[model samples]
Target chain A: MLEATIDASLLKDSIESLSVLVDEARVHISPEGIGVKAVDPANVAMVSFELQADAFDEYQAEESEIGLDLTRVLDILGVAEKTDKVKMKLEEDSRKLSISIGGISYTLTLLDPSTIRAEPRIPQLELPAEIVVNGKGFSRTIKAAEKISDHMSMGVEGETFFLEAEGDTDRMRQEMPRDELISITPGPARSLFSLDYLSDIAKPASKSNEVTLQIGNDFPIKINFEIAGGRGKVGYLLAPRIESE
Target chain B: MLEATIDASLLKDSIESLSVLVDEARVHISPEGIGVKAVDPANVAMVSFELQADAFDEYQAEESEIGLDLTRVLDILGVAEKTDKVKMKLEEDSRKLSISIGGISYTLTLLDPSTIRAEPRIPQLELPAEIVVNGKGFSRTIKAAEKISDHMSMGVEGETFFLEAEGDTDRMRQEMPRDELISITPGPARSLFSLDYLSDIAKPASKSNEVTLQIGNDFPIKINFEIAGGRGKVGYLLAPRIESE
Candidate 1:
């Protein structure tokens, strides 16, 4: 059983972050907050999300697990104003969640948590480099790379962080020096990742003021950012695609 | 021989007004101005467009007729900033138009004028009722009507002008009294038009501050508006659909 009231945009953005990685998620509701851990069907990317109880105007929940169809909820929230307050409640014996916003109310059938893929354990990584950059700049760089190739390389050399993409006939590169970046802890970190996953991650990360990226040579990259006015947090882990000789 | 310089947006909007009805058009370029009259493939709608010489920053031309692929020109103009100045030139012996905008230049091949359909002769119509309405409000009404049916009815009743549509299961109507409209001339003028044509015409009409609509009982409707800061004018004539008993 759970009940909560949150800002429409806050809830929408949070759900959007998760939806970019997975269509359906197993949401864990606790007294403190809501959490979701899921991996893409290809197992190439994983997403971890958390929304604090303080993010909501009012919140109450028992420890419970439920499956949610993110797309369906997004469609319903499409009409809501950013300033709207969305109310959601689920009774102990009810299999449907009641959602109300302004003059409209929707009864959303809840998916069974058991039917979803079990949450995967997030692996620990101690990357040698970390960079913080404005989300818009990062998103722009990813878009530029997309025009050149299907894969892009990210690395730190000296005090500069660079993203480069190469196609058979075209190549593009964007360099962000320490002065341009919010911050950078430079190290010998260079990795090539598929633009497919980075492009998807860029959608949610672009809304953030600061996005943290940690990378290692020939290893997976870790991206973290805060949302919902820093009351919620999201992290993405994308495995790098090995370069072909 | 022809050479002209004009605002990017003005040229784009002018071509857009004609492109909506026909993909290729025989454009008549005169020392005084440019004109195009074309009918849609279905021959149910006609467009008459004119861009005065005064609309261009620099204009010079000999009497000429050229066939232009509207879509191709629009695509080239898509990258231009609205404030950019577009320069166009055609040599007496050349079949290509040299277009320059900002730092980019494109040589667009001109279609043979003889290959395109002959310019249509615009029929004269003296409608009994005339209505002047805000372009935005008119566009909104057409959109709402689209949601309900494939066609809509427009007519003036007493002092009120009404736009309405009815589908098998839904209906929508919008009424604008004289106080709400710029002006309205009431008459026994009511006709139904295919939304397919009106919706396309609405694209350019929606950009004008005021659009004059002339209608007559069971007759085609006439729509006229100005563009390019009033230096350009466009007119449309749509054959009315017969309502079966």
Candidate 2:
């Protein structure tokens, strides 16, 4: 017997919005946190998601777990009539998860949890620099970069934050000074990452008016947002392109 | 003179798809059929499209015939983007007819065409006695219905044709006679109509392998199919539904 209440519609919407970017659905769940790790097929980019369990209305499980085949769960949730309370029952066989709402019943078979790869520990970074900006401003800045190039270069100096994209035929640049920045107190650092992945994940994060970004030299960029008063974090590790001159 | 060739992506895809559902758009052109129409806002769905005429290798316009908004163009082509050969040019200020691949471009702007309404004229029917079946089977039977249900519905005394729909909960039925009853005999006089419309309209027609149908009462009971084929022909329609109750 499993009982929990959440804004399933909101959660489903966020997942659907993020799935468009990467694959290999692996989400991490621990007593303290829940996270997701997905690397694009090319392996050039990886999106690591971490959310504190406090965000859930009631997250109860005798044992912490990770689940795969999220697509089926997503489909089942999508077909739900609305964002009403959803109840999930794990049959004794432990092979299927039955999801029910009002009267609709959808049973989704689960893969062996053991078969999924373990989430790798993201290496800690020592480099210095972080900036907090209005989530809307950051999302808008990345969306603008899409028109110029698929990749974006970001940097910080003192209080100013910068986003830049340059291609042979086109170029785009947006700068938000400390005063204009939602909240910024910067150290010196810079990095470049794919605008496609950033834009895609930014979709769910955009719901919040503000977000905090932690940046470092050539290291994974961490973006944190608040959802339901609980912290929702997305760590985007993008491999820097080596220019051959 | 501004002349450049776009690959014909947008116009070709949009017009071909739209023409299947909508009949016309407003921007008046010299001819009667070439102009496009807008889909009803409430009933019409949105499709994201972006293509520049410059992408093509050849583009020539002596003058601007019609400058249309994206929404207006989308509605005119009810179902948009069937094939890729969309070509456009302005002739006289009053007329602009762009030739699409499947059919000739006609010019006429629908007056308040955005209003969703039932088709003006229901086809006349003289069909008698109809049968119900699953959509897939109907689709398949129509293929054969062309040959069998053609001029015959072998009554209880007839050899080939018979109708049946079974059970209170599990509804399933089939009618296929063994002998020439499946062949030709105009004496029985079943019904006559093109399968083109069924081939075009009907969204639910494709969802189930079997489409539950009601046949011949007054007019043909419509069997809507998920739209297929580039031309936008009805996937399935039976005139018998009209005469049989």
The window of 10 residues in a row where model 1 chain B has the poorest summed lDDT is B100-109
TM-score of chain A of each: 0.98, 0.83
Worst 10 residues of 2 chain B by lDDT: B164-173
Model 2, position B125: C-alpha lDDT score = 41
TM-score, chain B, each candidate? 0.98, 0.30
| Cα misplacement distance, residue B32 of candidate 2 (Å) | 34
* Clash number for candidate 1: 0
Quantify all predictions' global Cα lDDT against the true fold.
Answer: 0.90, 0.49
Q: Name the lDDT of candidate 1.
A: 0.90
lDDT, candidate 1, A1-245, per-residue tens = 88999999889999999999899999999999999999999999999999999999999999988889999999999999979999999867647899999979998999998889999999999999999998977876776567557999999999999887776643556677899889999998999999999999999999999999999999999999998788889999999999875
Error of 1 at A164 (Å): 0.7
**Per-residue accuracy of model 1 over B103-142 as CA lDDT, tens digit each:** 3445666889999999999999999899999888898889
Q: At residue B61, what lDDT does model 2 achieve?
A: 38
Residue lDDT tens for model 2, A174-235 = 88888886777687767888887788767766776667777776666766566655566555
User: What's model 2's lDDT at A229?
Assistant: 58
